[model samples]
Every structure is written in C-alpha cells, then in structure tokens.
Target chain A: MAAAVETASHIRAARRGSIRGSRRKALFWSYFFLVLFVVIFLAPPFYMLITSLKSSGEISAQVNPWWVFHPTLENYLGLLTEPNFVTFFRNSAVVSLCVVAISMLISVPAAFALARMKFWGSATLATGVFLTYLIPESLLFIPFFRIFAFLRDITGIEFLNHWWVLIIVYPTLSVPFCTWILISYFASIPKELDEAALIDGAGYIQMLTKIFIPVALPGIIAATIFAFTVAWADFLYPLAFTTSADQLVLPVGIVTTLIKGDVYNWGQIMAGSLICAAPPLIIYAFLMDYYIAGLTAGATKG
Target chain B: MAEAVMSGVRAPAARRSSLRAIARRKPMIAFMMALPLILLILLLVVYPALYSIHLATLNRSMKRFVGFGNFLFLFKRDTFWMVVKQSVIFACTAVFFKTLIGIFLANFVHTIPTKGQRKWRGMLMVSWVIPTAISSITWFWLFDPSYSAFNWLLAKFFGTAPIPWLGEPLWARFCVILVNIWAGTPFFMIMYLAALKSVPEQLYEAAAIDGANWWQRLWYVTLPMMRNIISITVLFSLIVTFANFDIVRILTNGGPVDQTQIFATWAFQVGIQGNDIPLGASVSLFMFPILGVSAYFILRGVRRRSQEI
Candidate 1:
C-alpha cells in the first residue's frame, strides 16, 4: 500500500512538472513573436525618425539609409521656419478643434434624447446614425465637390478651396460616429441616477448637462479624441476641397507642397510627416485606455 | 372632514395632469435635441449620397441627362474592370492577412502576463496611431526606387538587386496592399485582444483537459467565442479597406500604368482630376453595392449583439 501510494504521488509530480515546462515554452515563443511583430510594426515610424534626422546631402549620398551617421536638425528647423508648413499646422489645428466642438454640440444632445427619452422614431433614428457612420467620405466627396461649386455659382459664397469649409464638411464625418458612441455611453448609465435627478426637478437640458455629461466623461473624451483624429487625419476632403497652398491642411499640404514633383525631399518630407502625425499620436499615447475602450465598445457594447 | 377630502382629491388630479404634461412634452424636447443631428445627416450624408446617383445620371457638362451613360462608359473600359478587380483583391488579401495576423498577435499578447500586456500593446499600435497619409509617405520613401531602404538592407545582407517597388505594376500593387496591412493589422489586433479578454478562461481549461492541442483549442474554443467580433471586425475592415484612398494616393497614385487603381483613386482620377465628374461619380457609386451589403451585416450584427446582451 505505501509503495503504491508513493508511485501515484511521483506520477502526479512528474505531470505537474511537464505541464509547467510546456507553459514556459509557450511563453518563450509568445515573447519571441511579440518582439518580432513589434519591430516590424514600428519600423516605418522609426525609419521616418531616422530619415528625418539626416541632412539632404547625406540622404542623397546613400551612406547606409538605416542609420544617420552625421544627423542634423536642419529638416526640423527648415519645416518649422517654412511658412507653408506652419500654415498647414495651423489649419489642421483649427479645423480639428472646430470639428470637435461642432461634433460635441450636435452629438451630445442627440445622444441624450435617443438613449434616454422614448421619442417618435428615436430607435430607428439611432440605427440610422450608425448606418450613416459607415458611409465613407470617398463616396460623398464627389457630390460635395459639385454641391460646393453649385453653391459658389449660385450664392457667390466661395465655398470651395478654403480651409474653413473643412470645418463644415468634417462634422458630417464626425457627428454621426460621435453621436453613435455617445448614445451607447448614455444608454449604459444606470436608470436610477437620471430618475433621481428628474425627481429633483431637473429639466431635460439641465439633467443632460449636470448628470449625463459628467458621468460619461470618459466616453466624451474618447469621442472627442476620435473626432479630433478624424478631422486631423482626413486626407480626402482637404485634398479634394482645398488645393491652394495657403489654405491646405497638414496632410495635403505636406504631400502636395513638399514633394514638388519627383524631386522628393526625403528629410523635410519625413520631418513634415512626423510633425503632422504628432497630435494624434500624442493623444493616443495619453488617452489610450479611453481610445481602446471606445473602439471595443463600438463592436462589443453596441 | 369635507374640506380635507376635497383638497386630497384636487392634489391627486393636479399631480396626474403634471405627469401627463411631462409625457406630452418629451417628444417635442427629444425632437429639438436631435434636430441638429437630423439636419446634418439629411443635408450632408443622405442628400449627397442620393445626389451622387443623380449626378451619375448626368452628362459630364451637366447640361444633359444621360442615364447610365457614365456606367456604360466604365463597363466598356478595361481600367474600370481593373479597378474593380484590384479593389476586391486589395480588400480581400489585406483583410485576410490582417485577421490572421491579428488573431495570432492577440493570442500572443493574451498569453503573456497581464502586467506586460499594456506596454506590448502600445508599442504594437504605433503603426496604426499614425495617420495613414503620413505613414504612407514614409512607406513611399522606403519603397523609393533609387534609394530604397528595403533594397539597401537586402543588398547588404542577401546580395539582392534593387526592387522596382512602385515602378512595376505588380510590385506597386503589392506595396500598396502591404502598407495597408501594416497600418490595419494593429486595429484587428486590438479588437481581437479585447474579445480575447472577454472569453472565459474556463472554456480553454476545459478544452485542455479534453486533450485539445493549441490549434484545436483556438479552433474549437477561441474562434467560436470570438465569432461575432471576428465577423464584425472583418466586415468593418472590409468596408474601410475597399474605400481606402490615402495609401494608394500617396504611395503609388494608381500609377505604373494605373495597375494599382482602386475605386476611390480611380474616382479621384476620373472625376476630380480627369475633369469628368459624372464618370467619377459613377466610379464611386460602384462601391455602393458592396458597402450596402456589408453595412447591412454590420447593422444586423450590432442589433443581435445588443439583443444578446
């Protein structure tokens, strides 16, 4: 009996050891592939930084493109001082801010109504908002282009080729998604808090401002980040609508003005691209949790 | 005693009337709140979408109505068919690889200790966080024919000749799709990771006890649990990838004899740049059928998920 019990216990211990051994092996491979993917994923931006630091002459000389042996800050200095680059930066900032403001102003109230109040067609309207969010800007830009031209012809308002026009166009892209996101957020808030606020004689607008907005601040931040990113990163609208160098936003400006036809200025171009990419990247870095939460919420919590 | 009874009855009646008034006022207030959103959608999204159809029916000069003329023109052209083929291929290939890579990376990230996952995830997501236009420019530089970094490394390590990345049609298409995969895979990774986290660990343990291997566990356990999210993510990525413009525009511009032209770029080329608005509108409208179908699936998926919850 004692010998049999010893054998059984020894067998159990061996099994446990093998299981742990397999787990360790799995973990080692996981980290191995994770490091591999991370390198591949980050290569471009890393390359951009590397290239941006090199002078034009060094870039042209082709002395090991991977490393910048004699790195220079001329590309950064040049773009910073360049009026066109500054104008592009300013235009992108203004457009992004205005779009975010407009998106919030429109989406918050709409989301509140749809999520809380049972109005006529509110459910269908909410679904409609989601469907509209799926409509790519590529599909709409053509008609928008013609419409702006038609308006220009009829009212002489000069709607085309101006950066401010982007402020108007961008909300159409942002508001629907923002409203959809906020509706889900507002819907997730428990029913009791709003009921208590209503019992306290809070008006519809007052309840929305005092109760819903603060509680859903994370959602609001996520939505704002999304709106700002959409506005800032938009290439099609700004590319198609605004063509003048002075009126162009960062993405379009950097691409069109910096390249200057086949004579690609790699240093300044990379520098400009890096600068253009900064705001969204910084926002993502800080508010990553909110951003990821918002992203998953769209699919999982819908 | 008569005064007390009368006052109590009057108070109940007054409270009922106020409640009814609040109920009556709710719809109007809701309408007022939703008015801006409604107007924006009606005037901007719905109107332009329908207007594009009407615009497609018009002649290039807009003086005459030529129903289906532009589409007929497109049907007769090889480039139009090429655009359709390339667009489908690009969307399909990119989404497939993205989904595969995403699931693998998500599983990898999931296997690691929770403490280290955040750092790894953040690092992996840098490619996606950068704007596509900016990143595509970097890619374009990397694929530059004369001074290609990829080729430089290839020559140093493997003694390979410089590749004509964008100068050749096939390579251009490959480069565009590769850049897209690079930019988009991180999104799939993040989404799948979230889904992975939600999957109950007990299910995997059960599979392991039943003598399921790693692949079997993934096949039987992980994929089944993540089916809804996978479909949703794939569908979403499909729509976006099909309509992608920036990568193609900045990287190749549908160049090397227009071999890399997708619907978006082709539309831009024909409509905006080519000075044929009707033709461009028609080209863009081709995206509608696919987009509409995917959008339908997404709506259904969202509704079902919401219902399930």
Candidate 2:
C-alpha cells in the first residue's frame, strides 16, 4: 500500500516537471527572438563602428566587410583635425545651447499660465500651440526664403545663411511643442501645492518663479534636451540657409564636407556621422528616463 | 513657532484680494505670461505661413500676380504626380510596418523579467538616439554598390548576385522606407511599452481565470486598453513621416529618374535649388490639407485633456 502511494505521488511530480520544462522552452524562444532583434536593430550603427575602425584601403570590394583588419584612430582623429570640423562642432554646440535656453525661457511660463491660469481664449491658444507643433519644417523653409527676402526688402537684414538666424527659426519649432509638453507636465502636478501658496499671500509671479519653475524642472529638462537634439540634428534649415562651410551645423557640415565629389571617404564619413550623433546619444544614454518621459508625455497627454 | 506661523497667516488679509478682483486679474496675468510665446508664434510661424500662401500666388520673379498658375503648372507635371504617389506610399508603408514591428517588439520586451527590461530598453533606444541623418548616412554606405555589407553577406551565404539597393528605382524607395522604419520603430516601441505597463495586471489575471487564451486576452483586454495610444501614435508618426526629407535626401535624393521624390525634396529642388520659390511654396502647401486633418484630431485631444486637468 505504501509503494503504491509513492508511485502515484511520483507520477504527479513528473507531470509538473514537464510543464515547467515547456515554460523554460517558451522563454528560450522568446529571448532568441529578442537577441535576434537586438542584432538587427544594432547592425547599421555597428557597421559604422567597424567600418570607421578600418583603414581606408581595407574597405575595398574584396575584403571581409565584417571585421577590421587594421584598426586605427585615423578616421576619428582625421575628422577632428579636418579644417572645418571644429567650426561645425562649435556652431552646433552654440546653437543647441542657445536654442535650449530660449525654448525654456519662452515655454516655461507660457505653459504654466496656459495650464493653470484661467483666461479668455487660453484653451484656443493651447490648442493652437499643439497645432503649430504639427506644422512640418518642410513647409516652412520656402516661406523662410521669401520671409528673409521680404525682410531684406524692408529691414535689410538678409537672414538667409546667417547662423544666428537658426536661433530665431528653431524656436518656432521648439516653443510650441515644449510649451505643449510643459502644459501637460505642469497640469499633472497636484493643484493643492500652488493653491496653498496662493492662500499664503504669494503673488502670481512669486508662485511661478519660486513654486512652478522649481517644481516643473523635469519637464524643463526634457524640453531642453528635445530642443538641443532638434538643433543639432537639423539639416534642411542649415542646408538651405547656411551654404558656407563655417556656418553649417554638424549633420549638414559632415555630409557636405566628408562625402566629396563621388570619391566617397567612407571611413571619415562614418566617423563624422558618429561624431555628429554623439551629443544626442550621450544625452539619451545618461538621461533616457527624462527623454522618454518627455516624448510620451508630449505624445499621450499633450 | 506659533508667532512665526501667525506672521505668515496675517499677510493673507492684506494680500488676498476679493474674488471678483482676482477673477478680473487672472486673464490679464495669464495674457502677460503668454505674450512672449504668442509673439514668437505669430512672428515666426503665422506670419511666415501667410507669406507662403502669398508667394504661391506670384510668378517666379515675385513680380507678377498669377492666381493658381503655380498649382496649374504643378498639376501638369508627371513628376508632381509621381511625388504625390511616392509620398503616400512611403508614409503609409513605413508607418504600418513600424507600428506592427513596434507592437511585437514592445510585447516581447514587456514579457521579459524586470531586471533585464531596462537594459534592453536602453539598447533598443540607441537607434532613435542617433540622428536620422547620421544613421541614414551609415545606411547609404551599407547600400553602396561595390562594397555593400548587405550584398557581401547575401553573396557569401546564399550565393546571391549583388543587389543594387539604391541604384534601381524600386529598391531605392525600399531603402529610404527601410531606414525610416528602423529609426522610427524604437519610438513606437518605448511608447507602447509605457502604455502596456499601465494596463492593470488584475484584468489579465481575470481574463486568464475565465479560460481565455493568449490571443483572446490580447484581443479582449490588451487591444481595448491600448486603442487610444495606438491611434495617436499613428497620427503623429504619419505627419512626421509624410513630411520626411532627410532620409530620402541622403539615401537617394529623388534619383533614378525622379521616382523617389517626395514633396519636400521636390520643393527643395524646385524652390530652393531650381530657383522657383512660388512653385515650391505651392507644392509644400499641398501637405497642409492632409496634415491639417491629422493635426485637428491631435489638437482636439490636447484641448480635451487640458480641460480635464
């Protein structure tokens, strides 16, 4: 009777074991595809890295394109030492920084007022802010040309090709979206904190500067990062306006300078792109939480 | 402590005005705060947009008034029709694939253990972190005819002939759309993952207890939960993808007999490069109607949510 009971218990244990084994198999397959996608997603940038490490002569038709035979710092160093690389880097840095500052200055208070303060047409204006974010830069550059010409016709400030003009044009893109994102963010904060201050006899300006701005810092960081990335990554405006090499931003500068006259310097071109991509990549790497928070908040809520 | 608190309390009677006075002041205060932003939008966006419409009405030299003349000329061109078709195909196909692949990838990543989730998310987001122009440049080299990495692999493994990724017309369009999907999929992945996280775990457990299978649970619970996010993400991506210029410009530049030209590039070519600003403005203005419809929905959503707040 004891042996029979033991055998029955053993059978139950074996059945449970098989179910666990199947679950393990399911997980193995799931991870298999996950790693597969990781490789696929990473391939292009990985290819750039390997190609950038290779010697110029080694990137020919016959060589194995997968690995670098003679890994060298030439591509990266050569890019840095290129005549206008420093200028491009500096220009991008200045523009991105200035755009971020300008975007924050304009967007923060506006978003606060729109989110919290009641006014006639504030809702309409908030909707309009979101609408402007939808307007593509593609439509704007043509009119930018005409507008600059019109400015030249009147104010005589030939706005085209001037690097600072981007400082002006980029805010149109950044402000509406940044303000929209902040509106959502500022709206998310509990009303009692500010209401408490209002009861404490805090004036509106004091509440905004001392309370709202301090509280909405995360959204501000997100907007700053977004504006910086847009400024750094912008191609068309710089391309359309800034033809001179010194005035160009990194993305535009790298393309026009590195890929010259059909004799493509694949090595330097790859390296240049990698460098051009570095600022945003570094910001994304370090502050990914804030970045995603901003993107989704801007999308889902705003 | 009582004295300190009392000092703070006494200021309200001196500072807190009556309700009607505060109500009167609120609009004035809000308007003052919003003035800088409003001025920036008007000067940069509204004024320039109005100027584009005016420019579209004039001749090439900006000297003659020619109503609908630029639009008439664009309608007559075969290339313009080609751009219209290609733009639609590119935006639709790219957005569709990105959404599909994003859902799959997001679901897969969501199922993994929490410890591994953050690392994988960071890795996946790297694609989006890199600028599109930079990544597209990398792809341009990968699609290079002679030293193409993709071709080299196909030849080595499958004994396939060298494929001209950017040389032929169809392949060129494919290359541009493919790069767009690669860059954009990460965005959808992360956003959907966030939405997936918000789904109540109890609902899934309840569905399972009711004997619903995986597909049934996804259909009945997950899809219903994620409906709003899916539509908005699609609309947002559609506008951006439809107006895309960088990837195509870098990869193909409307080449192989203008088969790949979208409105943006074609406009840049004619208006900026070809020195016909009026025609270019007209081409860009065509994007407004399609995008205006999409924007209306998004703005309505934003306005509704703000009202809720």
Considering every candidate listed, which one attains the maximal DockQ?
1
> Residue-wise lDDT of candidate 1 within B104-174, one digit each (tens)?
99999999999999999999999999999999999999998889999999999999989999999989989
Residue pairs clashing, model 2 = none
lDDT of 1 at A172: 89
Model 1: how far residue A41 lies from native, Å: 0.8
10 residues in a row with least lDDT, candidate 2 chain B: B1-10
lDDT of 1 by residue, A79-162 (tens): 989999999999999999999999999999998888877666777788888889999999999999999999999999999899
**Which pairs clash in the backbone of model 1?**
none
Q: Which candidate is the best by lDDT?
A: 1
Quote the lDDT for B27 in model 2.
71
Off by over 4 Å in 2: A1-26, B1-24, B301-309
Q: How many residue pairs clash per model?
A: 0, 0
- lDDT values of the candidates? 0.89, 0.84
lDDT by residue (tens digit), candidate 2, A194-297: 76877776787898888878888888888888888888888888888888888888888888887879788898888888888778888888888887898888
